[model samples]
Target chain A: MASAPAGTLYRGGEGMWSWVAHRITGVAVFFFLLVHVMDTALVRVSPAAYDAVIATYKTPIVNLMEVGLVGAVLYHALNGIRIVLVDFWEPGPRHQKAMLRGILVVWLLLMIPGAYFMMIHTIEYLFGSTS
Target chain B: MSLEIADPRSPGAVPSGRARNRGNFEKYSWIFMRVSGLVLVFLVLGHLLIMNVLDGGVQRINFGFVAGRWSSPFWQTWDLLQLWLAMLHGANGMRTVINDYAEKPSTNFRLRMLLYVVTVFIIALGTLVIFTFDPNLA
Candidate 1:
């Protein structure tokens, strides 16, 4: 029985993938948070020190990275809610697959506008703005 | 022949129940994740909206902007709370991750110690920055 073929237990699917994604995104975001807190702490040193470092964050490459960071945060946040629902809500486990769909849909809806807003400065800086 | 039924809720199966019976620390950490996660969904999202999406986005952030924001007690409190909660939540999450993946007991202990050290350092630094911020320093 130990070495038998897979059974009814969930092996790999939407639920499993989401769980993997959650761990990856969580670790990534956690590391970013560490660096961010360090950078923000530079404000205590001197304005020159803080501004000099922050200027790099405004560069085109880093700005693009910011969008990626936002995307990761959004996914983690949405999927986190779904996880909470599955744990707390009575019907959540039964409908977890559907919740995954809802999370993806909402994530897309938010990311579209979010990415646009976050990238506006980068876009303008790269290709000269009309206004 | 006797029947051998498999227990779905075995000690190894339910991490939460296992933690609960062991001690209060792990169980509280589990509850902390859910509560802090829910609060962070709003706090972090709002922070990203204001800092990364509003106005000129990242380009407009600098010492002056940070100074202005921290000048308000409300933003200061918001940031302080964010720093503490996010740090603790992330630390606990990382602890669980290390426990799961580290095959060697020694490696797990060392990694978790490092995580705790980093977590404490960052939280202290962030809190100090927020509290001791001087608008006129610039």
Candidate 2:
């Protein structure tokens, strides 16, 4: 099988970025899930141990990291819903572009409010309430 | 799924196929993968940094730490987003792989239905856990 030229478009409708993202997110989530479960199970270890674990979350940088986790999970969830519809339903291919746009708009809308709440709470927690 | 090369010069080789029908669903799925992938990069990376690095590292984490964080609405929402997004993104990706590979319609249907059930169940259960978490419970 001869390799195609560098810029040639593949025949299938599937986009490369999406496929890569899906796989990457899946692996990341799976890894985190293992760690999360193990950490949560620490509750059974002792109150002192559990408290020690929770304290690490207070660092400002850690809060920043939470922002990324939220973003990853949001993108993955929204796109996953889109994939589900495509696979199970045999709709005409023409509508693919429209559906993609719709997914993007929906994701943006949801994330805005979700992120806003996260920020407000973070600020309140870090700096003693002014109001 | 083998790709066939169409010959333009052959007498009988004039394309016989009709214009491909553009399905709305597929377009959306394609778009979704790109958008989701871009976002996942940031989220996953951020999560790793916070959990493994920054301020006393992983050793300082504890129940009071979680309680303190969640006591604020901010962390709760952050966590909520993470749970929902990751699960949905992963399930969607799996759906794509299934569609591309699954041959039998019945098998596809059964597998998808099962996937839906499990995905919904986990999402719901996770949401509940996040909201109802008790910091004081011994």
Candidate 3:
């Protein structure tokens, strides 16, 4: 197969997108984990110091980022299960596209509620003070 | 497994190995992805729930909240395992991704070098922070 020339889209299907999304989500989660560790480590320093750092999480921007984090983690987890199936199950490769669709469906089901709850509070926090 | 080194450039091709351990690293890597992924489901979900959803959400969490939790060895272990598994799983997954996408060998080598350095640095720092943590440091 001839490879595409420079400055062109790969135009890959679900398989390609799956891998791409997995890589992105994995990277995002890893970065978040890095920050999370550092922040949580604050507890070892002092109560006032730790509270000062964590208190910043309540702001609207960080709250919004938390929602993104939740979405990424859920997508990664669901798609990760799909990847595991493809690796170990005999029928995995055969139904790879179908599994990808299934992963999306599951991700939506789980993420909708998670996002709703997350936003409900964040939104309140965002506007509740003004109202 | 054939006794020849399958060219690694072929997409969708699993590297076939001739020797007993020739491709076992890849095999184990695959297995690790599945195993750690499964465990991460629980650890990560539980973590998100406790951190983001439970008891007034993120607003409720603070120094006393964390110190209270980590006072027990159980929470410490929970965090430690999560740190290790997530870092390893992500690094290994990225290794495969770079192998697949980076057409140039040099690009692959350099990208992986960066990934490894960051992974090791984060893991080491995280581990030290976890183990040497003193609740009384305040």
Candidate 4:
């Protein structure tokens, strides 16, 4: 029983997640882009109106959401780089896994600094403190 | 009286060479779709809730609002991460679509090359914008 392969549990190779992430991110980014464009276009209507819309982002909940957005972008960027490598260069399967791991490490390193800065900036802006 | 192996290319039969590679690539692609899809669900929903539902809602957004937000290192980082992840993910997905559908080698090469170029351009432009955004530019 221990050795038996479960029909429901299939172990796929490394590239699978990357591919799925690609599509999901693509759709998401497209939606966000549409909204962003529309919102920015609102600037043409009136600065006051635009400022009203922008001010909504200052809420705590929205700040939290921005964190998630950061994560998505980081993951997508790192994985996209991996996919590009695999597609154009055709790296070996073993190398591909290594590459994926490498991507994750890089993401971690970059994300830490990115998050720190963003946090500091947010805190300063909301609290009216330079610290 | 015939012992001929069935040619996979016959009517209703799979094209052996093409079918084999397609099957292999697709197996990997299916796995990717599942994993990325799950992550994306979280990333996207979180984004929507924050931008549209939180605080005073969409009405509060503006240049000064953005400046206020970015003044915090938090939003800057958040926007940065969002930019990189979404762009890369979208590009990779498109790469798969191109590989699966594009027939000619040259066509595939050109299309992919263009994709890479565009992806890089956007990423660079976005990063620059985030880091260099001037909120006081009147």
**lDDT values, one for every candidate:** 0.89, 0.62, 0.82, 0.63
lDDT of 2 by residue, B7-95 (tens): 66775655443333554867786776656655654665465446444454354556776677778897778777776766676677668
Tell me the tens digit of each residue's lDDT in model 2 across A8-86: 3223334345546656756566545545644555555566766665655545666556555556665665556556556
Candidate 3 structure quality by residue, lDDT tens digits, A23-129: 89998887788788777766666778788888788877888889899989988998888887887899987777899899899888877777767667677756677
Q: What is the interface RMSD of candidate 1, in Å?
A: 0.9
**Residue range B5-25, candidate 3, lDDT tens digits:** 656787567645533446578
| C-alpha TM-score for every candidate | 0.88, 0.50, 0.80, 0.48
* Candidate 4 residue spans exceeding 4 A from truth: A1-13, A90-92, A121-131, B1-138
DockQ of each: 0.71, 0.11, 0.50, 0.09
Error of 3 at A75 (Å): 0.5
RMSD of 1: 5.6
lDDT of 4 by residue, A42-106 (tens): 44455566666665555556665666566666676567656555655655344677888897888
Model number with the top lDDT: 1
Which parts of model 1 have CA positions greater than 4 angstroms off?
A: A1-10, A129-131, B1-22
Model 3 TM-score on a 0 to 1 scale? 0.80
lDDT of 1 by residue, B22-73 (tens): 7677778889999999999999989999999988788899999999999899
* Model 1: how far residue B24 lies from native, Å: 2.6
Model 1 docking category: medium
Q: Considering only chain B, report the TM-score of model 4.
A: 0.68
Error of 1 at A64 (Å): 0.7
Task: Determine which window of 10 residues in candidate 3 chain A has minimal summed lDDT.
Answer: A1-10
